[model samples]
Target: MSSTPDDSTAVIRKTALNAVHRKLGAKMVDFNGWDMPVEYPAGLIAEHLAVRSGVGIFDVSHMGDIRVSGRQALPAVQHITMNDASKLQLGQCQYSAMLYPQGTFVDDVIVHRFGENDFFFVINAGTREKDIAWVRENTRSFDCKVEHLSDDFTQIAIQGPRGVDVLQKLTDADLSKVKFYWFTRGTVCGLQDILIARTGYTAEDGFEIYVPTDTATSERVWNEVLAAGKEFGVLPCGLGARNTLRLEGKLALYGHEISDSITVWEAGLDRWLKMDKAEFIGRRSLERQQTDGVTRTLVGLEMIERGIGRDGYKVLDENGKQIGQVTSGSYAPFLKKNIDLAYVPLSHAKVDAVVGVEIRGNAVKAKVVPTPFYKRPKRS
Candidate 1:
């Protein structure tokens, strides 16, 4: 459970599992007006390492879930997003982004297709309201219904190599048969109406389970998963570990890696943008940028100096001239080194290109390396 206040004076909203988080002695912090746990008693490093070597669970209930349905759902999704939603088969999910008319991101989202006319979108928590409003405003031209389901569901992420082993004990679904990016509706921990998806933010084989917001069901599932995972050295992780895990995998964060000012081309996500498909929002601008070429591109950086590169840190050329800025940075627990993602001029994005990162008012040498500092081995 969570220890945050619930009175009118409180500014943050607590998740249904807030009390359970508090009971587990989690160190809670204000994450964009949500009282979320940053770490547990074992600390961030321990939690992070657990996910890399074994299994760990995360409370990601703050994520937004939006439903788009009706006869024109496919068309509505296709018009607003850059990806081709028509290609998605039932129970399939595609990683896509919504862009503004200026070719910059509105948000990066995961599009999950439930059926021919039903689609579920998982969006960033901080931008939930704005994304919902954007969807509603632009989707009015289509014959679809957009519903915000963020408040009606809770999400838990079970990650790492042993993720399947632990979760298989609780869910009746055939864990081994769920392919990556696919989802199935099944009973979890004897509870009905749960959606289990073979998807995760961490660079590992995992599952993200979505359950109803009913307090009793939420508590039961959370506790039962913990009990089932105890033998696998499963630890309850927090946002801090989640950040490190995702950073090692070079995953994009909303406000940091990709934001309102960052275009999809600059963010190194052009493959997901289907230019051949019918026109969508930002299509013209993105097409122009593609033809002209983007000035700056996102790249991965490895620190050569002792200091750690952090967000907003200036990326400078060899002569100390500002070239770009770091978006996401951290000391990756799995890699055992300081790594970061930054946007630099196209000239400096080559592999092994040396750049300087401003850390604590001093210039620290860093090398532009290949992205996804870490990648999981293929399962045999």
Candidate 2:
């Protein structure tokens, strides 16, 4: 249930709540060199349904947190990311990505504008070190300090329709005023300086709380949240459910949907890329890709047959020629259908376009469908 690093061998690192996950009987797996929980005793399907209907808490402490501060912080951030950091007001967050010079993704990130001279970046877990180096390497000419603060913080995401109600019980901050893509700092569960943000990967009304990594504080908050959420039927969810939830929402995974080889245009993330910006890494390449147009584009696919398409699966056209590949796929529990996200040539990316997914060497029928296979109803 628990693993420890040895003096003579390499071992995966564990989060602050690794012991707590084991105590809850979670099925643990090695995820990118981190011991993470894949599912709990309730099983992946049940956990997925719990988050869709009620509330579910996820231990997302594995995510990386980087801080950039100084007078030139904004400029440094603007130079590295594709989004316009200048448009962000204090306490606001924006979904963005950093790109390589070739126009491919370094990683998708969330930029939190904490102050005029300070910014917080939340990046993918697997690319934490690489992202930090990239940020620091690019900030050499600017008067900014890049700090890797991932080890100093523990993060938890409480998601679902009833998430706000459950978290409101423990925090004094006004949950109603926290709009989407915004964050506020306040006391939570008697602890001060907790950053609660109204953002989530599940495409639901939820909050992600960032707290210091003190063992006592982390365990206390985790336990208190679960206890308070009892009335709302909160489940301790795992990565398996998290993946399914995000996939249904059409959220991209690092290696699957977007990668070092996938450009912003091909990934359908052009909205996040600001081409008008005077300068930024990958701007030239992205501009050229935009003007010339990308040969392939990511699209949503719904399987017409019983089989489920998976990553690395080949996508075929009507003439049985391979057109693309499925990047992410799963049997969506909430929708009760098999769906996938794939990259296909421009000719085959149109909605309702017929295609075939090579499943176990057999071409299965599928159709291009609208993305975000599932969307949460807008809260009135």
Candidate 2 least-lDDT 10 residues: 1-10
For 1-380, candidate 1 gives per-residue lDDT tens digits of: 23222222246778888888999999999997888999999999999999999999999998888999999999999999999999999999999999999889999999999999899999988888889999999999999999988887779999999999999998889978889999998889887868999999998889999987777778888899899999999999999999999999988999998998999989989888899999899999998898999999999999998989999999999999999999999899889999999999989999999999999878899999997999998876
Candidate 1 weakest ten by summed lDDT:
1-10
Which whole-number lDDT from 0 to 100 does residue 321 have in model 2?
94
With candidate 2 superimposed using the best TM-score fit, by how many Å does residue 76's alpha carbon deviate from the native? 0.4
Write the residue-wise lDDT of candidate 2 on 252-298 in tens digits: 99999999999999999988999887699999998888889899999
lDDT of 2 at 339: 94
Backbone clash numbers for all candidates listed: 7, 0
Q: After superposition, how far is residue 376 of candidate 1 from its true place, in Å?
A: 0.7
As for candidate 2, its clashing pairs are none
